[model samples]
Target: MKITQTRDIRAANRWEIMHQVLEHSPISRVEICRRTGLNKATVSTIVKEWIDKGLLAETELGKSGGGRKPILLQPLHQAGAAVALEIDISQVQAILTDLSGERVLAREQFPTLGESFPQVYHKVCQALDKLLAEMPPSPYGLVGIGVAVHGVVDLSGMIRFIPRLGWRNIDLRSLLEERYHVPVSLDNDGNLAALAQQNLEQASLGPEGQGSEALPQSLAVVNVGDSISTGLITNGEVFRGFHGFANAIGHHTINLDEPVQCSCGKYGCWEQYCSNGAVIAYANTVLPQPISTLEELITLIRHQDPLARQVMDRFLTYLAVGLTNIIFIFDCQAIAISSELLSALPYYLPEVMRKMVLPITHVEKVVLSRLGKSGAILGAASQAVFQFFQDTAHAMEPGQ
Candidate 1:
């Protein structure tokens, strides 16, 4: 039977309060109420419930100026864990984390490319087994699992397509749920990365951080590797389009006259000009020697090799063009670039900024992702943690 889910306003409020406590621990109920705009009674009720559930704990008493010493609330580390797994181009990785997204254990294994889905699936299972075995005792044991797929995922938790991985129409969610017996969250890598980026930003801009009040509520996270894809986070949540493909900028046409074909069966797509693979491919076309890695190309550029400089100039120009288009379309508060190329952003950002349509403002919104490659994995685990907190039964369960 299909079960349609609806939100519980109380639960959402509880989540908000719980997140505030997690981010700013040792916080008083009055402060929580003030920050969340929740009534004192409501905050107290939720805090009591969390404490009863062993998900929150009361720390030392507050300062003496208060009438009665107010007890501070903090997230309980042993509440439960969330597992995150990712199926990338050549690897399967699993990570286990507690309620606050702190890593407890991790496992990774390389699955031979071009292998059958089942073979790759088996490899993922092995990594998960190892991760689970290494987890410590906790009240909530593996409450949720989040899977990150390197492709498009549908609402039904099916991997619809992944040309790079040769995966199509695979029911990965069902396969894992049947074996692991936990709520599973599935999303594309780019979307997960965006979530992680947002989480990172929030953490860094906590209540104590200077200018925390001025942080943006929306962002555009771009991943530029084998393919250029983007993920949009607006109003503190992901913005999935009708087809759950809002950020397929890689397939956007940037050069109509170009002859090269993209994996998406399109000519002169944005990725063809801006992706790391595209850079190497373009380098191969101009340089007599093939540039196998970005590091090699960067090294050549550092030495001012005429051929390397020419290829890099073109790559940067194309990257600037693509980024310019993104700025015009999203107009988001920030555009964070996520890739190994992030290290090089310092060198090329000025050029990219100069090419943008908008005038440079005092706000430095364009930057690099702090989480880097780990963003996707962290985001996956965070999704599971989100589900865990949202589950009324699980979140309210008292300690056994």
Candidate 2:
């Protein structure tokens, strides 16, 4: 066995070195040693192994003070690939990405509404097969696949519930793994989106000398689409409590006294009030005429229609209540709101903040998701990328 693969601690250190390269590539061996707190000799030895494994490649030489210039190392972008699928109520989105998280192949999106779980699963598998067939031959082939489910996915990969689509207790991970013979990861959409956001933020931090600042250690991503869900990220890791059900903030009670029914059969659930569906439901009651979409409602608000304004105010109030609850519970550095509605009504962020009981400084921390519709799918893809890194840690293990 190679020296770097012998000890578990050394394997972990090697993984960290590769991780730094993946995040901030075209980096020098000296800088990698500095960032990872490893000796120069150890870094050199591990880099040799990775280069031989074709997982990493040395770039052009860097300037030197007196001796030979240092060789910059980066992830071998074409060595392997990852596939990510995001299953939503109406459609599924898929992408094939490289080790550096760059989309190597064209993405695919198809309808899923009114389709059975088996049908949706078949489409997902087909999508993966098609992408794989398109990829140019590489040493590592396909590393793994990650799926972002728009519902509660248990730790065992069983999808417990997705009320909007009427899905319940589906073992999606096993179904795919059994057929494809590839590693599979299943997670809730909110959590995966949050993970994607976290990775994007981290990747934005440029090379060692660049002045890019790091993201906050703790944050929450609240997605208010047809449904509502929150993903809590703490210290760069997702906090999936008890059966991977953490941050199901949608079902939390917000109006116990005058409870409104939710599709989940819950009373006064936050989702029933703050989701886009909830906003439409509330709008229908107050508007002179019923409107089904957020764009129409926003257009009415822009025209200064008093009734539309009233519904907007109520929606903001309920949303603010939910935001406050999230802040109090997580005490995170920031809360990122993801919704087509937020994009429609970006100007009302201040109004929503004003409704919050917290100080203006704290309330100002709420921000809209920068990722938009791509967050969940990209996040799902990131999971496969993460697994690749873990496997890379032990790439030199006997018969690995």
Candidate 3:
């Protein structure tokens, strides 16, 4: 809980004090002093300002000896609200959470529109409108919208590239700004998923994972749906390399000698062999039947069909090889597989774990994400939450 002042204080250090209280609330002035190293007088000044601003409230008195009550303080849950949005070619998911990443409200999902970018953007705005109509009116408007896309993106809302959606050089941020008239943060979905895992498991991660040993300094989140790839976190920060192009493990050539066309304009990429599409293709090759969704394939695998088992086995093998490289390269604390894919892994992770050790002996704990399919949106929202709490000095500007 200890927080060091990272920058020059402004606005009476309002955001910093509010952030610390939000993180370690129901805490006394003494504890706040100890955690933040801010003098008792300065802490008093900030706490009073927050209380007056309707941003924090005093709870029970403290028990620092039999003295006058040192009132406990916590953030006002309604001081502000943030919107998180997930988008792709197929569907868009949204959630509104408070500063603590807790959903104080409901979630919304809607089908994506036609091929036109403007159409899909309108659909998203409509979805937000619908969700907002259902909420109880409050003074705090939406803090900002955090958008998660499927391509490379800078902090600006530009869609640098997304082949599935055929979006390139699209000014998505500016478009959203025109709609919401508020700040907008944009990032790729994979990184958002990684943020979701970190936020959802914060109590169980960092230097404090559930087990005896401390959490690893690195993590890799792999989403196995229409696409196969990874998002990496190291030392508690997303690692986007020189050009914001990192952790595209799906394009890693797993089948180097066996050439096949890949979605990323490559040959023999791993996604061609390990994605859900690959699983469906393998099943169709053996069973000669059409399959519509990945969920159906899971049902077949659960039933122990030979074709399902055969495809799953190969899929797990290739997945482990790529994940093994991730393990070796980053030596992460844990690997989080999406919940949609974990069910099949229950029937296969034992074998995957066994094979993962085929190349390396030190086994990192591999776990299934607890957030389900909503992870990307939740993750994107968490980015907003963190951004909202961070001191201004650390806050990267809209286009930075």
Largest TM-score belongs to which candidate? 2
Stretches of candidate 1 above 4 Å error?
1-7, 61-70, 206-213, 359-364, 393-400
lDDT tens readout by residue for model 3, 1-400: 4455443353325565665565556678777677567788988976786676566788877666676878888777776788888786577878777766666486878776345777787778888887667655555567677888866675454678765676778887788779777677888777889877765555452221244556556888887766665789998788877777675677778776866677577777777877766777876877657776677778887887888777777888888888787787777778888735565457566677777843454546887777656677777776776566553324422232
Q: Each model's RMSD to truth, in Å?
A: 3.6, 3.2, 4.5
By TM-score rank, best first, the candidates go: 2, 1, 3
Looking at candidate 3, the ten consecutive residues that score lowest on lDDT are: 391-400
Better of 1 and 2 by TM-score: 2
lDDT, candidate 1, 1-400, per-residue tens: 3434333456667788887876677788987887889999989888888888888898898775647888888888677888898787656778888877756565665765678898888888888888888778898888889988777777667898776677889998889999999999999878888988877776666444435545577788888876667888889878888878776777888899988677777798888887777788889999888978999888887888999988877877777778777777777778888767546545766666666666653334787787777778788988888777778433453441
Quantify all predictions' global Cα lDDT against the true fold: 0.78, 0.81, 0.70
List runs of model 2 lying over 4 Å from the truth: 1-6, 62-69, 206-214, 257-260, 359-364
Model 2 score (lDDT): 0.81
Better of 2 and 3 by lDDT: 2
Q: Which residue pairs in candidate 2 collide?
A: none
In order of appearance, the predictions have TM-scores of 0.89, 0.90, 0.85
